[model samples]
Target: MRLTPFRAFDWNLRSCGLHGHVTYRPDEEPLAERLHTSTPVGEAWRCLRCGTFALGAPAAAGPADEAPLVLRGRALRDAVILRLLAAERGIRGLLLLLLAYGIYRFDGSRQALRKTLDDYLPLLKPAAMKAGVDLEHAGPVRLIEHALTLKHSTLLLVSAGVLAYGILQLTEAVGLWLMKRWGEYVAVVGTSIFVPLEVYELVEGFTWLKVGALVVNLAAVVYLVWSKRLFGIRGGHAAFEAERHAESLLAVEHAAALA
Candidate 1:
């Protein structure tokens, strides 16, 4: 929409007594001129003097064909988080979709699936025996056997569940990438649902990976609730809007002038 510049990094101009003013190096003048003129309307660029990053320029214009404007933040942290989460969700969705396809294929040709597993068994047996594992009673072996014995209806149910999960993950991925508020709410709820299970797993057995997962989930929940002000934290939705407004270039310019 607006495509205005955003200050992505803090600069202590007060220390240099320059306020918001900056002086670029002689060598940087040519590059600055190019950046000033040729930077795409919605592209990000850095301040020539302080090297701080900003998205769009003061006079940047949005194409009539562009989508509605996103209220990007002055700080880059939240943008980074949103992008990372989008990537994570997209990967998870893809994996789930692959797993669902595999399950469907296995159910469609049980004989072929069994034959494939049998063929691989010889190669796997030696390794298992060397590791002192009994293949007959191993969890993986039993799970495979159970899968083979599943009725068509059960297989269908399993495939449906996996497909649904994949769809949910993909939906969240796209929404978060767009920085939608609904996406944040969905992510917060989805992650919160697993917190108890993750905690129980940690209580059952302690491992660095488990602890790390728990910590990461908890951190995401806290960050969304506190930083994004979900469900009325701080001054609630009004405060959220006000904060975004305050981060705009005009607001920054006004503050600099007053300072």
Candidate 2:
């Protein structure tokens, strides 16, 4: 018996079963020759996606310039990148929402938290003194004390702002993950707007994590603007659509026919 080696996942075939094979009939001679052949039962057209021979007349017959069954080559690569960005946006959004919720909850129960801290501080402080740690001026304790002093209205505003930022992140995530034109616009514009803020934060205190985030956002903005032709850059929407049309499987077959 012969064994077959493992094959890399084929995105083309992933949807073929559910959507049915995409078979097209090109009336032109050389293109049709490349795409279809006669079988014992009938003429079998090649599926544009999986490249399987399906017995029957083509699902649609005409020129070979029809839309593709699935994204291929550079289009597929672009899709992967978009989804990776989307995932990052999604995670950041969730974390921000949780942070906002934590602040809100802290505002409500701060007194209780302080009482608990006071109750435990005598025991903790003795250990801290032995360990050369200052319980009164420790970073976490200081932050909690400062937060306890904030006005209710101020806490409310801060929570609301964080929640709004979180929602924006989630919205961008959905758009990018769907690979919509509007989503690309949202990501580019949103990231661009916040980039200055990120820079300001980095300037205040540098951290590799912040630097990484700044770089990623900058790269995403550049990619969406230039590669996706957002705004009027790179010839705008018409050129973007034309590129997709040109990158279709049928377009390649058409070029092959000419060759």
Candidate 3:
């Protein structure tokens, strides 16, 4: 049997070796000995992240339980996913903000724009006809006409609503991009709120974009809840911390047992 060559993008491992090396010492003698060693030049300590010894004193020292639980493996994967989601939110937020600004500008200059369109539209009619284009009934022309028909108050309210939604999107982006626990909660809640609206839009008019958005939102909510163990789910905060400590403890025991 022949084995297929495989490639893997081990994010945390790469991060540890390249940029995020975490070294530590424990107060306990036996545990400390496993992590620290004598070297020709000086003392060296094992990196908690990649298990590679570093030729220097430990960056941090504390009880084994207090050692930093730097993100690794699945945790790093979670950070990458959250940041991607944050990027999506940031883009949507900016687009919504631009839309809001456009609406505000249109509301303020509705009469002038309408006058300009009316004055210029007829002048282009002959050229439009020659080019096989219906300038008067074009999408942009129809949209402008319809927007002008709306009351000023309605336009202002719509713009304000869009602006608020855009601000909310930006807030979510900040939290998720930073990978804060509160941000995860914010994203989960915010996304949950939009799921129904997305579903309604999908039901009213089926589109792949809406379907994709809906799928992403639901998946994010599930991932955050299950993996982060939020809101009393799957033993919640205590269990979450315990799991991290457990990983560190296993590493400590493995190193010490080897000695």
In the range 1-259, model 2's lDDT, one tens digit per residue, is 6665535667556656666777776667778788777887889877766677778887787765654535644565688899999999999999999999999999989889989988998889989999999999998998888988999999999999999999999999999999999999989988999999999999999999999999999999998999999898989999988877766655437434433
lDDT of model 3 at position 133: 100
TM-score to native of every candidate shown: 0.66, 0.81, 0.84
Residues 1-259, model 3: lDDT tens digits = 7765534666757887678667777888889988788988998877765566778878887787777767766677778898999999999999999999999998888889989998999999999999999998897899889899999999999999999899988899999999788888888888899888899999999989889888988998999899889998999989987898887766555545545
In model 1, which runs have C-alpha deviations exceeding 4 angstroms? 1-74, 119-123, 200-207, 249-251, 254-259
- Give the CA lDDT, 0 to 100, for residue 60 in model 1: 30
Clashes of 3: 0
lDDT of 1 at 200: 93
Residue-pair clashes per candidate:
1, 0, 0
lDDT of 1 by residue, 26-97 (tens): 123344343333334565434432334445543332321121222323334576788898898899899999
What C-alpha lDDT, on a 0 to 100 scale, does residue 8 get in candidate 3?
A: 65
Q: Residue 215 of model 2: what lDDT?
A: 97
Off by over 4 Å in 2: 1-21, 27-30, 39-43, 50-62, 125-139, 249-259
Residue 18 lDDT in model 3? Answer: 72
Select the stronger candidate by TM-score from 2 and 3. 3
* Model 3 pairs whose backbones collide: none
> Considering every candidate listed, which one attains the maximal TM-score?
3
Question: Which regions of candidate 3 are displaced past 4 Å?
Answer: 1-6, 119-142, 248-259
Instruction: Provide C-alpha RMSD values for all models, in order.
Output: 10.6, 4.6, 3.3
